[model samples]
Target: MQKNSGKSVLLLFILLIVSTLSAGCTDNSSTSQTIQTSEETSTRTLTDALGRTVEIPESVDYVICSGVGSLRYLTYLEAQDKIIGVERSETTNSASNAKPYSLANPQFSTDYPVFGETRGMDDPEKILSLDPLPEVIIKTYSATGFDPVELQEKTGIPVVIVNTGDLADNKEDLYESLRIIGEVVGKEERAEEVISFFDENIADLKERIADIPEEDKPTCYVGGIGRAGGPQGFQSTEPTYPPFLFTNAINVAYGDMDINVADVSKEKIIEWDPEIIFLDLNTIECGEDRSGLRLLQNDESYRQLQAVQSGNVYGVLPFNQYATNFGSVLADSYFAGKTLYPDKFEDVDLENKTIEIYTFLVCKGDEELGREIYNTMINVYGTPAFAKLDI
Candidate 1:
């Protein structure tokens, strides 16, 4: 009996040893799986306008901007140096007035090679051929050409889509886009700075005119707004134009219209007969005979308008080119404010303000370059811009 018990005990000890070794192996296998998972998955990602969760490097130093306004945003962040190449449209613009972002940084034309056709046709092969091979492609308007996912798969590079939100309705989208670009370019501070600048200035502007009665506000109209197909004469107008919104100017075309834009008949404009009219100089692109300015100069109906006859008409910079010229938008607001309520904005110098916005946004606070771009804008947008139209 004593011998049988000893054998049973020895067998039990053997079974316990096997069970302990199996448990050790199981623990090691689990540890190995955890390590593999850690290697394969990463947490660094950003959600873009398309609602795409895109994985990004911890620090991105090389990038390509695709679609409209992408490059403009990059310029705002002062990250143009990170660009691999530029779009053909940017280089091919034959208009007298250069796009503001390009105007601020002329090197975009001469220094970088053309990446692909403009308006969303990013060529993956061409992108891959660029020196230092862009690590990421930042895009806006993904629906236009190559799909962001397709572009990523073709080039074996990551693509992030963004949105160019307008000042009126989708301002939050605009701010988010800036934040994404800022994070990608490691310029988060700059992104906030730009956002804060907009917020603070917008408040200051609205505050300045807050006390004035709506009935006392000057009746105004803005025309010659640019569209997808280029300049669209005086008929192109925005009811909720930012400049008008900021100063509480009574837009003759406001009340019922498209949320983003609208058109007005010549007869309707005659009916409104706004006390003041501000012409977006983008119409200059359509040539003097066809542009909004020409219509105002030649049309007897427009000539008879009180605002034009009284010389209360003025030229404001174009706020949209590639995508909203943000600096130009704010600049136009000040000009609009100064035009309507000279006493309220009397302390504000129009020329100095434009330069200030340009310097901070594109020139990286370089006042000399800001003034240079300001002069270029004036040269193209005549009536010496930011002043009374000699009409």
Candidate 2:
């Protein structure tokens, strides 16, 4: 019985060793499965501005903006650091003050790599060659340039489309765009704050002049409005100009035109002879012969207008530098409110308000930085960019 007990102990040790070997083999297979599952779980889906459901990385740290105002949105989010590259137009020396976002972050033109030409015309080759390759492409305007879907297929990166809805009637759409972008870059809170800021400002602008009698409202007109190509002449204007809407000032061009924007006849201007004439500073870019400022100051027809005679003509920042400079739009609204209704906005300081709007929107609450950008803007466009015209 003692001999059999020793043999039993040896057999039990051998069986234990065999079981350990089998468990080790099972663990190796399980590890491979876990790595495979990890790869599969690395991505999640997103619904973009176009209502297209797209699959994007669960953790996105780098991206490229492919459309007009796309980089502007990034600046608004204060997430411009996440941008791996940008469009070529943004880096150009021409029209330096055209896009305030570009001016606010000069690094966008110099430090980051170039992705493609302006207006979403992406070059997939350039995109793929970027160091530390981007994880996604965010686009705003799609009417022209590379289609987001095709660009995604060519570059092998998720392309997320967003909208920079017009600042006026479609403003809610713009808010949704901001929120969508915020979600992608982990700036959800910032996006909501921006929307709230716009809402609060709009409400305040409206309330300040709400009690003013309609008969007391002065007739207003805006000209030299910039468009897709470049600066237009004094005759060019927007009927639904956002600044006009914000200040509740009556725009003579608002209901007279068949389209949202067009060049009104000089004869019509002589007829309406708006009590207040607001010229877009971009008109200075129209060259000596074509400049809106040149026309207002030199042209016999424009000089004869009542606003010009009374020195009611004022200079407002251009909001349409590359499809609506959102920050500039807000800034212009404040100036318009103050100029048209001094009594209502007597407490408002133009310089301080400009700094506040630029800081909150582009400088991320850095008051000093906002002040610097404002100074740079006026320097480029001249002091008349946001004040009473010498005319």
- For every candidate structure, what is the RMSD over all alpha carbons to the true structure, in angstroms? 7.9, 3.1
Q: Model 1, range 68-136, lDDT digits (tens) per residue?
A: 889999998999999979888777644533777898777787889888887888888899899999878
Model 1, residue 281: C-alpha shift (Å): 1.2
Off by over 4 Å in 1: 1-43, 93-97, 258-262
Which candidate tops TM-score? 2
Cα error, residue 114 of model 2, in Å, equals 1.1
TM-score per candidate: 0.87, 0.91
lDDT of each: 0.86, 0.85
lDDT of 2 by residue, 107-221 (tens): 8878988989888888989999999799888998866799777888898898888987977989977988898888888899999998888889889899999998899899999
* Clash total of candidate 2: 0
Off by over 4 Å in 2: 1-33
Best candidate per lDDT, number?
Answer: 1
